[model samples]
Target: MIRLGLRLTLSGGREAAARLAVIAAAVALGVGLLLSTLAALNAVTTQNNRNAWLNTGAVTAEQEHAPSTADPLWWLLRADNFDGHLIGRIDLAATGPHAPIPPGIPRLPGPGEFYASPALGALLRTVPADQLADRYPGHQVGTIGDSALPGPDSLVIVIGRTPAQLSGDPEARHVTSIMTASPADCSGSNCRVGTNSNGMDLILSVVAAALIFPVLILIATATRLAATRREQRFAAMRLIGATPRQVSAVSAVESSVAAVIGVAFGFGLFYLVRPLLAQVDFTNTPFFLSDLSLNATDVLLIALGVPVGAAVSARLALRRVQISPLGVTRRVTPRPPRAYRVIPLVAGLLELAYFIGRRPADSGGQIRAFLPGIFLVLGGIVFAGPWLTMIGGRLMARRTHRPARLVAGRRLSDDPKAGFRAVSGLVLALCITSAAVGVINALTAEQGVPQGSASLSSTVIGDYRHYDDHGNQLDSAASPPEALLSALRATAGVQGLTVIHADPHPAPSDHLAGGLATCAQLATLPTAFGHCPAGAQTASVGPSFSVVGLDRLLSWPAVWPSAPATAAQLQNLPVDQIVVATDGSKSAIEQARTLLATAYPDQEQPFTIAEDRSQMSQRLSGYQQLADVVIAVSFPVAGCSLAVSVAGGLRDRKRPFSLLRLTGVQLGVLRRVVMLESAVPLLVVAAVAIGTGFLTAQLFLQAQFGYSLRAPGAEYYLIIGGGLVAALAVIGSTLPLLTRITGPEVARNE
Candidate 1:
């Protein structure tokens, strides 16, 4: 019996090779990604943490006497395992009148670093663009306090000068070093800093919640194994005295072999792809290279557990096969109680209904409110698959003409669950394709009219010394200053002019507002703030602005004069002076005061700042780039999962495919049948997923993000068509196995 069993299994190996080959391939790929992800995580954690001490940099103070709700300094000083720790005191004028000098590591600049993109290094808090111009005309620059945090990204300043620039300042006494921090360091650290394509860290967390996808994946895998593996083969072995456990063991052995090989290959590819990803300079991220890694545990689990899991799953399914191999012919399929299959869907719907009616009261604090949409979509897909299959099968059955069509239609009808399998891949693929298309569209779009202004003409201000609008330098020791403005205005299409100026602040990043200002005419100063009156105070310019009343522009909301800031609020007081921003209102208020103060009463200011139109959709595009990082991993993994499903199915039917030629069916028809077989099932799954994903996007993205998605063109077809094609290709790759499986039947039985 053992010899016969071995012979049977061996003869069939060529046919079953398709299943083993594909599953092996998938396992290898999946394992590879798992390894690379682990490796990358470890590399980042190890290298950047800088001996743990650097990773945990913070301020510690000695509050010997304190209350439970006391100052943060006291807690810092009261370390349970107290050893010498690095603490850099941040003395801001807002926190104290004469802030004491700090006493710790002095933060210094690294070498050969000229300009770190705002995306890289420590996040410098953006000093509002309007505040870059000299406020009191010559107030020496300094920082005071922090305002509300925008989100996960902490704001820091990227000064133009090196750390050496301020080496001698009294303010530098306690000033320590600056290093990049992970989002977890602060409540809002997870914002643009460490997040991916799925919004920010919060949304990424939601996407990571996708860890659950694999549990179901394992189940589906087990189900497919049972479906393809015949009942009588296992039963006959048992009848010949092999124990049921032995059969289970064999199944597990098979699964393990395939998983190990698949994983090894998958990880290799993941690392290979890392270099490509590294080339992309993600916005708002510092540029640096870090080594990648693969965790030992993740590899071990996939290698060891997948086979065991397959065995356990197969045993549960095969126990019934052992009960009665005599049921052979009918064993190709058996009826189940309607409730057995129906109950799962009913249960899902009930759960879905309950969830919708009573969303968890603690659904959110800041960004979590929108995660439900993803769940709603995934659940909807799971529940809707069978229905979609039934509908799609019905439609296919009507149109099918050849024997292949007949076979395809019959297969779909015989097992509705197969439809679910097909839909899963299709839906996932379509979602990814649509999302990719959207991303491509967004990245290529224009930056738009300009930020924070209504001026019509383009303006640049950092290089104020030379070039004119026509790209020619003034070519003189003295630039006409307004000559470029005259040239542009002289052109026919020029409606308005804009201006950008360098930040007069002392820090190197002072140039980074990169001092963009806009106006209708070059002579028109960025107004009130950037310009200094001839007779104004001769203070060296730091960060100061001339106050403008919000009452002046009924349009611009960002800085309206009604907000009421007086001269007293100024760190240094100028009699009859008020602090303001580079914004238009401040410009107007400054102009009025300066004209009254230094007396330039007759200047031309035109159509106001409020007239500019901005495309708010671009912001979503920015956020999407971040979201991609968070959710990008899922797409390829899902594709691999579908690949295995298709490959496995083809392997299971190799013998049957070979046997079909004996019935005189054309090889072409049989091949078509196989393709249809895979396609029919998948279309349903995609349909189900599409419905679910759409609703989920609506509920989550629209409601939470204030982003609206519409079919800008034939997006629906593109989504559906793309999904089906990918599903077909992955499953279709198994076609060559058909010829191999069918070609060798004569030798086996003879």
Candidate 2:
């Protein structure tokens, strides 16, 4: 009896299986994405662990203070409110005539703790440009800085009870000082820099996972109906003698099998993408990571849960094996009260609420815009979808002059439910396509980021080489490259010329070696002009971009003409250092940086070149983020809707075609009506989808996400054309199916 029941149920499940296949594919897509996300998280955690173990001595209770006022090192070591040992002291002082900023000194070390300083960057510490900057920990030399802390004049101190006690200092340039941690706290990059590279991506991964479920549910909502349609043969067995329970069990089995297959496919996709994911290297950035964390838990969860969930979801989705009293009253009519009509009302209230509740507290502009746009879409779908179906049906009926055309029109009206489904699917497809195109356009647009109102166009700082008066090239090996500047200033077409050399932190190197890049806190006086004032004194900045170029006593920038150069960045530079390009052009920038370190062991330096955005357009042209799977699913669902529409148009002729073949009408005429009907709705739907898609695209991607929506100008129009062509193709594909004139099958064929 069970076997008989199983056969009966399986026979009735073709329709459900067909519908559920699409859902299964969508499920597979979700699983693939989930796998990738899990891998990324695992990579992050693994690297975090390795890093913690590698740099274990970074945490301490010393407060690791950077003397706020008047060299606090002296005050810190005074033994007034002390407990453990006093890690030495750090200070800066003018060591020569051209000493960077002859400010108060800040370097000292009571060796007992740990005196750690790097001799690498000391070469660039122009006593005249900066002192203590070369002394701080983890400071970048040439990156973003205001050239603070006189290098030659400033120094860092490291004093403690033991060598291990002064193992690592806060990246106060030069890693100036290190001291013991009473209790070791092996922390990750949160304590240092570069520990967490893809924090934002981690959040995005979770969101991506959440979005997957909704799309799957919507697409698969009708799967059961499909199964029932296809399994008529099996259902007949149940009518004869099979039990209902056995029938349901067979359904469960089929659903379970499909779900498992889908999950397996998803995992295959995940592993396929792993190699590509592993190739990314984000090391230079302070927040970079060469290795992403990968965890098995996430992958395993999806592998196991998705299959079970799919099976359960299928089981629950099918409400009953027993035919309802109403089911027995079964009507061939597919019409259901148009649930899509509420779309408009829901959308309206959402819009009304959007405008009323918005506030600055929510980061206005984009968020406010997102509100109304979303509501409008939902409303449009609900209201417009049903309306389009009714109207399309009515129009077909109204326009059909002949008996054949007339019959097709009324049939379409009678089947508005199916019509609505197809049109809605088309509209949805259009929305996604437009949104994706818009984002791609925004990302690949050739335009550099503007700095305030300044435009950075194609300006060149041509091959940089310097020459002397006698046409003899100056030696770039020994001293600061001053000769090159004089010659460049003399050259024509040189709209602006400003030479940047390395600025050093006066701090020691070891403490600086452990990550957190900026630690230089230079004291400055204001200038009259908006810029820094150049004088006997120097200016400095931390590794980060915040500007601190003035002391309280200096005149404001409005009153001064220039920003001061520290002694380190000016006319003076340490002698004897013939900076070599060690690593060569293969890594010209990195090689230059490394050479600087080898030559001057005790200062901070930057990457070889600063960012220049003269050709912004040229830089952003190659990225293509095409989500093909999504497009494939959407386009076909839309085509099926088109086929139903065409079929509706030929309903009266379904019998006529049967009669014509019996009497004498041509097959071609039947084919033509199918074509005409399909064309009409396709065009109508294409127009609606295109128009709505554009508006939705502009609203979400640009207005909401702050992406550019500039008329891809002509490109956008071309997109409209593409949409039309796509609609045509869908209609065309279904012509064969639509004209399947089965010689008047049962009387309902009409």
Candidate 3:
């Protein structure tokens, strides 16, 4: 029986070969996409693991303060911002001869030497020394190994400093050894930094969830192509004394052979496109090529599972043939789907509503609570699709006057499940796209700065004070030296300068009055800090004020009120803040920042309003890019599924269509019939899916952040429009085939 099946599948003429080819193509697409998603996830994990050790500290405050001579190294990690990019700086000091080395470098460097990642090294060569290189203060000894960096574009510097140089820094740790575990695996104060991949992981999970269903649908649809013809052939064999089990084995063998070929081609397709996939920056940094790979176990599972699943689906499709061969041979229509098929969808919606009412306080909590509802909703769409199609078909049959409408509606009502299956992939893709677009547009909206403050775009504010997490002042450096101040004033883009003096003994209630400046000097400050009070000689400065909160303070600048003060008092106070107004050009702003950083390399770098906005938008942009990529990939996959299913439908109904043509029906009428058969169920279910998606997005946002519905961006409309057009185009492509198949020469009975 197995040998017979193989021969039939391989050499059963052109029609059989076409069926095998279509099935193989659909399965190949599904497997390729599945493996690609899995590889991307693996890359995220690998990157997180590689960069984990840099953020993990092994010493306590006590050990850091009074380190024993036996301690191997002193480690201090600091973050530096250049333009809008973040650079990680690790300052190391060797305290003992037998210091434990980090993963990237061969040995610890002495003073005046540092190791830079390949990306950072290249950056240093391109950017001027005054802007970035001056901060590192060392010659590049070598490049850090890939093992120490998260991705190829990561900027990292490992500098060697003397023990005395690091002793003054309170945050520095006296390290005995480095911990290799990621932040999620580490506990307590030892994990100095939080994981950066949480958002990426969540987005990827959403994408994976959105994609997997369509892939499965495509595979199932592929297996069922030409299913009616196969059942008839099997029914004849059954009537000729073949056992049901033997018939089942033959069906399984045919489907499994196509699937096995598809699996091999899928692996080839993944390898072919991997380099392009590696270039997508899901977290604002492209992944290393080697990171995006499946392990042996994953490979083995996919290789075995796909073919077996295909075989099973093929076997299940022949149940009618097995039970009573005469039923299939006589072209019996199966029982219609029931109203209860819609229950799961309603239940899922109710579950989502229930959770939304509870309103979780944190995002993590909301995600955990919404997962079940999301799964239920997705599953419900699949369950309710056939029922919805049946209802729509019956309504069309009742109302339509056209012959095409009557024929299409009757066919749909008889096998609504098959009609729905042809376009199910598209319905699901639109649903996921709608939800993602809604959330992304809302979250990525810009929080613009106040009006009339555009002049502050090139103004730089430098502060020399450090504060703890609670906003309490830890310590403040003395005013900038006269030479540094002179050099800054002479900088190419510096247009104006103002010095803010610190009040030595501010009253207990006057926490914001850390600095004082003359009214004329304050007037020269950024417009964001409202015009100095009229007729006031001196006024107090706000707490470590910078461009960071300029947007929030626009409406209430008077919170730091001005007061009367003597010129002697202003002169007596120490300087704490330096404001430099530039030429309003990007280069000018960067030049001023470089000078300040050179003066106080250890303190936070000076910042501009533009840079602050850029930094915030940069993070949001990454999410937008990821959403776009996922949507872009999904549309073609769904289109392919729709195309294959439409072609298969034409092939199965060729005899009926040819007979209609012979009976004097026009080609135009037949085209409309085919179009309506696919489009009616598609348009109806698609509308429902889209509404559900937006509703899901709104509920999720409300539970997580108390947010209401916001309009999605232009891209949302484009995706939805493009998806519809693509579906129509795929359907149209099969129309010509309909005309060819229904010719008088091919209209004879099988």
Among these predictions, the greatest lDDT belongs to: 3
Q: Which 10 consecutive positions of candidate 1 have the poorest summed lDDT?
A: 74-83
Q: What is the C-alpha lDDT of each candidate?
A: 0.41, 0.39, 0.78
lDDT by residue (tens digit), candidate 3, 483-569: 877887788877777777766666667545667676776666666565566667777665445543544533436535575666566
Ranking of candidates on TM-score, top first: 3, 1, 2
Query: Per-residue lDDT tens digits of candidate 1, residues 1-750?
Result: 334434443455664565556566555555555554455444434333331122122322221222233111100100000011111112221112222222122222122222222221222234232222211122223331122111112222212222343332222322122223433333231222232223334433443445335334533453354244555566666677777667666655555555556556765777677666444423332223353444677667656665566556655556566666555434465442132343443443344333443444432433444344444445545555655565666677788676777778767766655545644644554544444344333333332223333231122111112345475323211112344345434434333333333222324543112122221222243332333333332222322121112223222222211112222222222211112122233333323222222221011111122211112233444445544543445555555666666655665566677677776767788788878776776655555455544444433433433444454348546645654566567667767767765665642552
TM-score of every prediction relative to native: 0.59, 0.49, 0.91
Where model 3 places Cα greater than 4 Å from the true spot, the runs are 58-70, 187-204, 357-367, 445-463, 493-518, 547-554, 558-560, 565-586, 608-626
Candidate RMSDs in order: 13.3, 15.3, 3.5
- How far is 659's C-alpha from truth in model 2 (Å)? 9.8
lDDT of 2 at 158: 30
lDDT of 2 by residue, 592-644 (tens): 33334333333223221112332222223221212333343445544444443
Ranking by lDDT: 3, 1, 2
Q: Any idea what lDDT model 3 has?
A: 0.78
For candidate 1, the per-residue lDDT at 221 reads 57
